[model samples]
Target chain A: MKNIFTIIKKEFSRFFKDKRMVITVLLPGLLIFAVYSLMGTVFSGMESVDENYKPKAYIVAAPQNLEETFSSILEITEKPSLEEAKKAVTEGELDIVVVFPSDFSQTIGTATPPDVKIFYNSAERNSVYGYTFVTAVLGQINTSAFTVNAASDKFDLATGRDITGNLMSTIMPMLMFALLASGCIAVAPESIAGEKERGTMATMLITPIRRVELALGKIISLTCFALLSGISSFLGVILSLPKLMGGMVGAEAAAFYSVGDYFMVLAIIISVVLVIISAFSVVSAYAKSVKEAGSLISPLMILVIVLGMATMFFAGNVPHVAIYIVPLLGSGLAMSSIMSFSVNPLGFALSIISNLVITAAFVVLLAFMFKSEKIMFKK
Target chain B: MTEILKVENLKKSFNLSRKQQKLEKTYQKVKVAVNDLTFSAYKGEIFGLLGPNGAGKTTTLRMLATLIKPDGGNAFIDGKSIINEENEVRRKIGFLTSELKLEDFFTPNYLFGFFSELYGVDKTTAAQRRQVLFSKFGIDKFAEVKFGNLSTGMKQKVSLVISIVHDPELIIFDEPTNGLDVLTAKVVTDFLEELRAEGKTIILSTHIFSLVEKLCDRVGIIINGQLIALDTLENLTKEKNLEDTFFELYEKTTGDRI
Candidate 1:
């Protein structure tokens, strides 16, 4: 027991002494924080743009009292012809153009209504902005029309906005899986395969300690580092969340996650990290060198990225069995469930069991490798 | 002097498959690494297993060190069977080979501490023994330097230090001075002599006949995995020098056999 502890201590000391290990462990965390923080700043700044700007609108074939109705909200441009207005919209000179057909208000007063063309260039940013402004004015006009027909009911607009915020929170699970895969790939390969390439492995083996003890020590240390990296990545996603949401909606609607949900999401992420680390440790032990290990584990990163994107795009509850058995994907589904406050206790329990079983299998494989002289001394 | 280590009809063979055999064209045959080798080392004697490169010297040492298993036969260290009680045999012997390299990241002092703990030596006793060994071997001066940054001679000395950190009853060294400078080699040879004088059993494998002639109380010559000769230096050197006697024995075994 003392011998094993001594070996573990020696191994850790050797790892901490290397500058490469330090950089490998910390650089990903730092990079994620820096990148996300910068994105957050950009997105937040864009979110702060004022909503009251009366963008210029070109009108052709003006309806009766239409000028009076829109005068308070829109900055009217020159009364151009239909063709000229279309050209203006295309040339970026007009924010939007409203064309009233020949029988505009006459048809509206009767049963037959003429079509009103709201022409805006979808390719231009300013044109989209003008179209959005006009849509808001149109919405208010429709609301007044409804009020004139019947008494208005008390309807909270904030509740509708919060629903959109809930939908966006669904992407959190995929982000967590991405974090786990990235962090594990960076640390696990180097811990075992790198030691072999650097010729430190043989020295480690000749010590009086058993192979299982060494494997456990390495796995525990690497899992801790990987989990730290996962946390940093989760932080990155969190830091960027408000900006991403605020850009799509208002600041009030963007703060979707509660303190409880954040902790639950973090727990799910840690579980995913353990699964990735255990799987990668086995891969690392199988590889003859660090380069080979890196190559072997690279596909895992791609899988995470693809799965994360898929989860983000596809919303709703996952099947119970899949939520438990599918390694990183299971944790991802659980994370999304947590963010949406739709926790399934059965799925969570099964997921923990499955991950623990897989981890134990990896540990057993590593122990077996350590005991095999052929494997340990393979050229 | 009492017998500390004994090898009885020890043999080890590894399977060698020809390219055609690997393709399922023929059956693989066993190639012997150590064949029916037998020798013994008494306490206070420096025993040398002399052989050329590719001889079974390393295989023999590995078996005795319990790092590898012999195919047929057994070895005993301090009356403990290597085949039955490996850990006990390991505890009684300190083994080193030229192929085994030290980790460059650690200082000699740190490595010493690590091995001492591994050998189950008490802290104070380990420290005291470390200090004495470091000074006696003159490795104390550069004990703090990383093994990688040290010169070849210094690294070799550190390797020796870590091997005997627990001060086992019997010490086994495989080509201990292969890569060392003359001065370092002399220091190592002198140190081995001192260990022998202190009534410690020492086993060394070397290709250098002169060193064996000077230091070894008994010598065993192995060729093609078989021990061809085993006797005291004087007995093996009947009427010729050690070098001539080695070649004469080599010719007799390998001449018509190949």
Candidate 2:
């Protein structure tokens, strides 16, 4: 027991003494702050359409009173030929072009609805807004044409914004998982394979301590470092939440994650850190050198990033129960679930329990490897 | 002198692919690394197992250290069977090999503390023992220097100190002076004499015949995974010098000119 503690203490002290480790711990926080602050500034500086409301419209056959009806809303432009108008729309010079056939009034008078061709470039970046504005203008003209009472339907803009906020909430936890995996990869391999390469492992092993105890002590220390990185990332995302929400939807969308939600996210993040550290421990043991260990564990970091993004894109529905049982993916799904405030107790419990089990199993595997003369004595 | 360490008909074999000798197929056969090797070291004696490269001396020492299990035999350390009671055997032995490396990030003092703790030495006793060992070895002056910054000789001294921190009954060193300078080598040889005076059993493996002739009470020669000769240095060198005796043993085992 004392030997194990001594090894653990020495490992941690060596970690702190390395300049690379200190930079690793601080770099992520600094990067998150810098990146989000820049994003916030860019988002706040965007010019809204409401501020400059000049509605450009193309008229084909100018009705005598058409000018009067749209006098306030429309900015009348010179009627160009069809080819010129299409070119203008393609070039984004015109919002939408309305073409009236030769029998415009006659077509409207008949029972058949008049075919008023609205030409706009759908490939244009802001074409969706152009289409919506054109539709609103047409509706106003119809309302004026027939004075029958028309009921206005109120659309809840908040629902779409709320879903987006929920998506962000799901994304934040997954990001935490990725950060933990990255941090673990950066440190765990060196803890084992690096020591072996440096010829320190044999020195530590001959002590009266059991190999399993040493393995466990390393796992515990790594878990602590991984969890610290996870929490730091969680806090980074949380601090930037208001700014992200404001830019993505609006201020009202920022209220999705409360203190309770934060706590759950934190719990999920810690579980995720454990799972990653455990996985890295196995890889580290298999590696013959620190470089080899890094290569072995690099796939894990990539997997975490991919899983986090997948969880974000597929927020509401995780595909299968089997995914929740998979090592790193399970933590990601559980974290996403917690962030969305849809806690499945069974899934969460399974993730935590499975992580612990996997960690224990890896520690045992490392102990066995440490005992192997083939591995330990390999030149 | 009482026998403190013994190896009886010890043998170790490793799987070597034989298909490469014929076709390019992948089949392996057992190749003996140490074949029926037997030797013993008594208390207060410096025993040397001398051999050229690939002579199974290391394999023999490793078996005695309980680092590896022998294929066909057992070793006893302080009356404890290495095969049956490995932990007890390990506790009673201090094993070192040239291949064993130290963590370079630690100072000698830090590493001493670590090994002392692992040896189950209490904090106060460990500190006292560390001070005494450092001073006696003349390592106290640079005890705070990191192992990486220290010379190879200093590192060897530190390795020796950590190996014997618990003061085991049997000390095993493989190629202890292989890479040391003349000065450092002399220091180590002198230290081994002091350890012999203190009644500790010392088993060393070396390729240097002169050093073995000077230090060893008894000498054993191994070649091609077999112990070819075992006797006191005087008897082995009765009619010839130690070099001629080594050449004769090598020729006898390998059927080669020396």
Candidate 3:
């Protein structure tokens, strides 16, 4: 235990005392915040339509009874005939043109109602909105056979919280995995493989300290660093969640999650970080240098990305407990479930337990590798 | 003499990579590095394994240091098996080679404390040992300097100091002065003599004949992983000088012209 603590202290000092490394650990958080917020602002600008602009319409053979309702939505214009109104709309001088048969409003409820011809370009954004607005007004006044979703207080039935939760479950898992894996990549390999390359690791191997102690110490200290890096970026995403998701979700997702939700997510993050760091630590022990370890870890990184995305495809029903026990992917599943307010107690417990077991197995494998001179002393 | 290290049929071999096989100009899949080597060193003595480069001198010492495993047999350090009791063996011996490096990020002072903790040394003894050894090696002058910033000689000295942070009963050095300037070389040779005077058993491997003659109490001459001569310096050098005896043995043992 003392030896493990000693090794951990050494590793911590190696990282914390280096100003450049500390900067690297914190810079991602700041960068994430700035980039995400900028994306939100830019995306929102592109999707919004100007509120001051009204749809222009030329109504021909207008029904006297419905005239009052149509005038409120469209800029009602006078045209002599239906053919002239269609020509004006085709020329793009008018936003929309509508022809109601001579007794259209009166015939709306009859067996064969007069067909209202609305001419609007589907390709034009303004024309699309114009067509929609004009149809809604006609639907209200026509009082025909039936209206689809007309004047029902709120038909969608999804709350702001639901939207926020859906957004979180969809996007957060991938982003979180990517950020945390990157953090592990930045430090874990360099700790073991860098020491091997520099010839410093063998110095410790010669001591009375057990290889298990060395491996544990390295993994734990590296876990702390990875968490710092993962959390900083995570906090950045959380703080910027409102800005980044505002355009799509329409509600602040950040405001919907409670402290308990964050804690649950944090639990998954820690377990995931442990598993990643331990696996990478084993890779580092197997590799001869940091560059080699990085090459080896690249394929594993791709695997992590695929796992992170796995939860999204199987979002609502995470097939089986088998899925929850699959290391990195399991953490993603549990986190998505928690963030979306659909926590499965059994699956969550299984994923975290499986992570710890996998991490322990990796540590033992790392210790075995440490004792192998063939691997450690490979030229 | 009280034997402190015992070697019995210790052997090691390595698989040749294709690139290595190509470089070695051979189709053989394995290279025998150390072969059935046997010897003993006693307390208060410096035993030198003398051989040309690649003659398994370093390999033999590496096995004794528990840095590598022996395929065929085992050795003992203070009666602890290098294979079965590796941790205990490590606790009993201080092994240094050019390959064992101190972290460049840490000061010598910090590394000494870190290694001492690994060795399970008490703080008071560690402090006292540090005071004596650091001053002796002149490491105290720059004890707080990060190893990367230290001069080459200082870095080597710091590595040597840290290797024996617990002051183990046995010391093993592989090519202790392989690439030293003459002045730095003399300092190392003098340190070995000082260690001997303190009654610590030392095992060193070197190809330099003069170094063996100047410092070793007994010498084992190895050629192609086989021990060809084992005797006191006086007995080995009674009729012929050390170099002539080595070449004569080399020609007789391997049937190669010198």
Q: Say which candidate scores most in DockQ.
A: 3
Instruction: Compose the digit string of candidate 1's lDDT tens values, residues A1-379.
Output: 5655675587678777887766666666567656654654554212222467776788767755767867777788984476776667665577678766676556654544455557775434456676666666655654323111022321111232333334444556665576667778877887788776665665555555676777777777777778777777666665555454444444453256677766766666666676778778787887889898999888877886676666554354464456556766666666666665566666666666677777778878887876665655555
Candidate 3 lDDT over residue span B27-86, tens digit each: 999999999999999999999999888899888888888889999988999999998999
CAPRI quality band, candidate 1:
acceptable
Candidate 1 lDDT, tens digit per residue, B99-151? 66778888999988988887788999999989998997788899998888999
Ranked by DockQ from best down, the candidates are: 3, 2, 1
Q: Which candidate would rank higher by lDDT, 2 or 3? A: 3
What TM value does chain A in model 3 reach? 0.71
Winner on DockQ between 2 and 3 is: 3
Pick the lDDT winner: 3
Kindly report which residue stretches of model 1 are placed more than 4 angstroms away from their true locations once superposed.
A37-171, A246-267, A300-314, B16-30, B256-258
Q: Interface RMSD for each candidate model?
A: 2.2, 1.7, 0.7
lDDT tens readout by residue for model 2, A79-113: 45866765576555766566655565665556654
Give the Cα error of residue B117 in candidate 1, in Å: 2.2
TM-score of each: 0.76, 0.78, 0.83
Winner by DockQ between candidate 2 and candidate 1:
2
* CAPRI docking class of candidate 3: high
* Candidate 2 chain B worst ten-residue window by lDDT: B19-28
Q: In model 2, which regions exceed 4 Å deviation?
A: A39-167, A246-260, A318-323, B17-30
Instruction: Go through the candidates in order and give each one's DockQ.
Output: 0.40, 0.43, 0.80
